[model samples]
Target: MSIAKRLASQTAIYGVSSIVGRVLNTLLVPVYTARFAAAEYGIVTGLYAYVAFLNVVFTYGMETTYFRFANRPDTDRRELYSRVMTLLLLSSALLTTVLALLARPLMSLLSLPPGHERYALWIALILGLDAVAAIPFARLRLENKARKFAAIRLANILLNVGLNLFFIVFCPDVLAGKYLAGLRPLVEGLYDPTIGVGYVFISNLAASAFTLLLLGRELLDFRPQLTLAPLRPLLQYAYPIMLMGLAGMVNETLDRILLPRWLPEGFYPGKSNLAAVGIYGACYKISILMSLVIQAFKYAAEPFFFGQSNDKNSPRTFALVLKWFTLCCAMLFVGVSVNVELVARVFLQRPEYLEGLAVVPVLLLANLFLGVYWNLSVWFKLTDKTYYGTYIGFAGAVLTVALNFLLIPLLGYMGSALATLACYFLMAALCWWLGERHFPVPYPVARLLAWLALAVGVVALSWWLPVAEGWPRYGLQALLTLGFVGLVGVVEGRRLRTI
Candidate 1:
């Protein structure tokens, strides 16, 4: 089979898990926003932002490191897996214990409410289970078990969503005497209305635990050997990658963490810190369409790239993938940006949470740049210059912090969104320039930029159009989206026919 076909197939399978899972996850946004006040939902958003950072810390780049060494000619795949698994298991256990013990202090440091220290415990357990399961999930990707990967992933999502519904919806009905009287006591015991967003965390923890159960075979398959021979090389490779992951998370999520705290004390006198956070967080999900696409591509691309590293035409292949990725991401950006109000209403569904709708376009464009940056990032990974990734990520993180700190106070979450856009645009440009100097991939920069330009132009035209909100506006946007697609097909069609 062709490399492109393989990657496409892998992407499709991964997309089933990522796209479906995230779409379902996104659906919960309305549920969350509807049930909790902006401030309450903000707590959920802030905690999860910390969760993203902690997840990176727990896994410590082992998944990528596993891919790096597993492809080496001299490495024993089984031993490497065992060593990596051993290292993660020990560290995850120790980290979980330490964090659980320090849960109260950590909660205080994070400026969470007075009595919610257990949030720390739940987050710690969730991250620990997920970290330990990381290698197993990556193993599925490495072995080309995409269907199994999707199945396990979807199962986890289904379980989590199911539990969330039961706790948040069904149990409440029962407790309120809207259902089974006999089960009222049990439902009352399980469902605490005051817990609010805590139910979301508990649901997630349950799902993570369930995923570990599903991955039992992968977990048990690895030997308990922890020798220094393989350990040294893996850690050496992973350390910088971990730093990169840390910085990347900072770039990705630190804004959500910082926004509430960074906003002026009386910025929203009527609202709590979480209220602004909740608003920014909800609007941020508006860009998940692009984010999920990038995530699915990354899931499939990482293993595919490593597997094809030794191929003679790998550079050309990477170039083609990058071009196509940019094209798709550009289309997504225009699609979401043009249909922003409809998308916002569908996902968020609450007027209050929609205050940050203006950030959607900025963030959509930011994620587009981010997707391109991910494509460019493969260069450093391929060249074993992983430290370059560390440098770029840290630089982006610095920009993120500085810009967000400056902007949030001035413009609220809009400033945060702009900061994100600036960080990613700079990162993508820097990576492209550096990639040319080190591992030239002949990225179709002009063609890619042309597509992006056209996408942005169409979106701009749609926005500036005087069509009133309703079917007329949607119809106009749809026509513009279709026009862009047709234009791409016409341009790329001629080139493909010649090939």
Candidate 2:
């Protein structure tokens, strides 16, 4: 198969798991918004923001390191996998224990109520299970076990969704005598309504444990090695990646983390800062449509790029990847941004959650740039100058923090959205400039920018046209979205045919 074809197939399989699974997960947003007040859901959002940061620390970049070393010509793949898994297991255990011990203090620091320390503890276990499972999942990708990977991921999502529905929806209804009156006693024994949003964490923890169990075949060959000799070089290479991951998380999530703390009381009129955080978080899910595509591409592209590093035409292949990636993202940016109100209405059940819908376009564009940065990052990774990624990530992190601090007081979450857009745009631009200096790829920079600009223009026109609501607005958006896709087809028809 052609490189593009193979990557597409792999990405499609991964996308089935990521895109479909996340779509199912996204469906729970209505349930969450319906059942819990914005402040209650804010706890879920805030805790998960911390989870994103800790996940990087727990896995410590071993997944990418595994791909790098395992692709080396002289390395023993089995030994490398075993050592990586062993290191991950030990570190995850140590980290989880420390986190569990400090759960109460951390809860206080996170601004949670006095009695919610168990939330932190649950988060600790979830992170440890996910961290330890990282290598086995990465191993499947390296081995081209995309089907197995997709199946397990989908199963995990399905189970989480099932458990969430059972706890958050079914049990409460049963207890209320909505149905299955005889099961009320059984439900009462198992379910606590006061647990409320805690069920989100519980459902996730159960899913993580179940996923780890499902990967037993991958872990069958694992043997613990306490000695650091085999892991020393890997650690040397991976620590920078961990730092980069941490900094990247700052750029990606620090806004959500800082919004509630930094924003003044009564900033949004009748909403607490925590409620605003909840609104921002729920609206942010609308932008995940773009991120889902990026994530699926990342899953496939990382290994593909490394394996193709030695190919003569690899630069062109990389260029083609970015070209198509940007084009598709442009379509998504236009499509989702134009119909954002309709999308928001569907996903966010509460009218209050719709307050932050203004941030969706900015965030969609931000995530597009993030995906572009990921593509450009293959340069540093392939060159083994991964520290360059660290520098770039920290640069973006600093900018994100500075921008958030400066703008949150002025424009609220819109300011946060703008900060994200600026951070990702800077990172993508900087990565491209540095990649050209060290390892040039013939990326179609002007064309890609044109596509993005066109997308933005289309979205602006869709909004500015002042069409009436209902089918008319929907029809116009549909026409404009389809129009953009059609233009891309005409422009790239020959290239598409060849591919």
Candidate 3:
């Protein structure tokens, strides 16, 4: 089979888990917006922002490191897996213990109310379990066990979605003496009606624990072999990656984390800054169309890239992949940005949460650059110049923070969106420039920019040109989307046919 065909097949398998799972998870946005007020939802958003950062800390780049070492010619794959798994297990245990011990203090640090340390405790467990389970998950991907990988991931997401439905939808009825009167006491004992948003975190914790249990084969089948000999080299390789991952998280999530804190006190009447955070978070969900595609591509592409690194035509393969990836992302940007209003109307159950819809297009464009940046990052990983990636990530992090600080007070969450776009654009541009210098791939730069421009131009025309909102506007958007797709087909048709 051709490389493109193989990558597409792998991506489809991974997408069944990632895209479908995220779509299911996103279905809860209405439930969340319905059950929790904006401020309440903000708390959920804020805590999960920290969760993203800590996840990087807990896993500490082991997944990529595992792929790196495991794919090499001389490495003993089993021993390497065992060693990486052991290190992660130990670190996760230690981190969980520390967090459990200091949950109260950390909650206080996070500016939670006096009684909400349980959220911290739950988050700690969730991150710890997920961190350790990460290696086994990566192992499945490395061994081309995409079926098992998708199964486990889909299982976890389904469990989480189920629990979310039960707790948010049905538990209230039970607690209100509407159904299952006998279980009311049990439900009341475990659930507080006022803690509506907290249930999201709790549901996630249950899912994480269940996932660990499901991966028993990877964790329990073989006795763990402990050795420190490979430890030094792995850490040396991983440290820079850890920095890059952490910085990437900051670029990705700092806006969510800092929006509430940085906004002026009483920015909105009768609402805490959490409401602002909540609004931003809710609107951000609209951008997930792009994010989901990028994520699935990363899942499939990472191992594929590493596996093909030794091939004579690998650089050509990478270049072609980036070209196609850019085309897809551009189409995604146009599709989502053009129909955002419809998406908002359909998915946003609460009219009040629609206030932040303006940020969706901005963030969609931002995520396009992020996807491009990920494709460009193959150079650093292939050339062992991962430190360059670290520098780019930190630079983007700084840009994100600086822009957020400068703009949040003025533009609120819109400022955050703009900052993210700038950070990612800069990062992608820098990676491309550096990539050419160090490990050039014949990326079709002009064609990619042209595709991006066409997408943006269509989005601009649709957004700016006064079109009456009715079947007419819908018709225009559909045409615009189809036009972009047709343009890509025309430009890439011959190459695709050859493939």
Q: Top model by lDDT, which number?
A: 2
Worst 10 residues of 2 by lDDT: 221-230
Q: Sort all candidates by lDDT, best to worst.
A: 2, 3, 1
Better of 2 and 3 by TM-score: 2
lDDT digits (tens) for residues 1-499 of candidate 1: 7778889899999999999888898888888877778888888888889888888899998999999999989988988889889999999999999989988887776577678988999999999999999999999999999999999999999988888888888888787788788998787777788887788999999999999999999999988977777588778888899999889889889999888779987786677777889988888887878899999999999999888889999899899898888887887888788888788778786788877888888889999999999889888998899999989998999999999989989998889999999999888998999999998898989878877877878888888999787898899888988888887778887865543
Taken over the whole model, the C-alpha lDDT of each candidate is 0.88, 0.92, 0.89
Ranking of all candidate structures by their TM-score, best first: 2, 1, 3
Clashing pairs in 2: none
- Which RMSD does model 2 reach against the true structure? 0.9
The global Cα lDDT (0 to 1) of model 2 is 0.92
RMSD per model, one decimal: 1.6, 0.9, 1.7
In terms of lDDT, which candidate is stronger, 1 or 2? 2
What would the TM-scores of all predictions be? 0.97, 0.99, 0.96
Q: How accurate is candidate 3 locally (lDDT)?
A: 0.89
Residue 461's lDDT within candidate 2 is 92
Per-residue lDDT of candidate 2, residues 324-371 (tens digit): 999989988998998887888888998899888889999999999999
